[model samples]
Target: MVMTIGLPTQQKTRNNQLYVEHLSDDIQDHVYQAILEGVYKMFQMFGGSLSEVLADPSKKGKLKDFLDWQIPRLRVQHADLLDVFQGVQFLPLDKHAFLRVQCFVNRLEGRFGEIR
Candidate 1:
């Protein structure tokens, strides 16, 4: 005999994609892309690889400093993204910091169309 199971309705209807997936095309193309580029530039300014920085807890403060510097500039032009950032605590590092940053980058890459 074969058995079948169904997911709960709430689980079945849940959206697993990042909030960026729900944004309008223009916002995703312009605003989200700008935010991703800004973050890429900030990673450049950090003078280290993303994995290196994220893996080392000692590097957290330096990463936070870069975010502090970058956020105000982004706020001027990408306030909507900033709001999402704040809502998501995107700039802060917690115990799950590595996963958080990785997931953020992955989502951006997925939405903006990855080069690799």
Candidate 2:
């Protein structure tokens, strides 16, 4: 099953448009920081940095499996922050999920210029 974390359908508008709610800059930054922290913790648990995992094919596959397993549990643990990642369409189980996840990580790396 493709598990998703999002707001209820009833909360969507009648038009059915994918309207992204605007968050204040401060709140957005806070959410970004929280996500980074969670992702970093995951990397630490895997005993490697993002760059290390990406460079090593074996580790990359392992990370994909690890993320697929962990994301749901993390969602439950961080339920209060679920809205920050609302509208995400990919579950780690999806066929192309790992590529999308890699792209997301690459974007983050670009934005921050380093994993530190």
Candidate 3:
């Protein structure tokens, strides 16, 4: 049976695991809004174009599963900065230390023509 707002969906399986379909369009939008902001975009992992995958219904499950597995893995790997909502802390370092990193970034940008 379908459930209303503020109630969990009920399942009939022995383990009582609720089987949910893909998120409704409204819920998906709200989630995207919460996670991303102006000029910032979600990172895409696979080589295929996001628009191409999203246009086909059959691709959605695989894409969703990949994201579900990858996001948490990324969060754990970058937990220090990922947990922060505001700007990250990279201040109060010695001048040379800061410049060293900056120089590396400058070299990368020179070679790659913008880091993203």
Q: How many residue pairs clash per model?
A: 0, 0, 0
Per-prediction TM-score to the true structure, in the order listed: 0.38, 0.40, 0.29
Best to worst by TM-score, what's the order? 2, 1, 3
Write candidate 1's Cα lDDT for 25-44 as tens digits: 33433445556666766676
Cand. 2 TM to true fold? 0.40
| Cα-based lDDT for every prediction | 0.57, 0.60, 0.50
lDDT by residue (tens digit), candidate 3, 1-116? 11122223333544666564433432333333334331123425352456767688788776677667655554332223224443456668798998999899889988997584
Better of 1 and 3 by lDDT: 1
The whole-model C-alpha lDDT of candidate 1 against the native structure comes to 0.57
Higher-scoring candidate on lDDT, 1 or 2: 2
| CA deviation > 4 Å runs, candidate 2 | 1-29, 76-78, 81-116
Q: What lDDT tens digits, residue by residue, belong to model 2 across residues 1-116?
A: 12333443323454877565543332344454555567667667765787787778788787777777766565443434553554366544665887777788989988997683
Task: Kindly report the root-mean-square deviation of model 3 from the true structure over all alpha carbons.
Answer: 14.9
Highest TM-score among the candidates is held by which one? 2
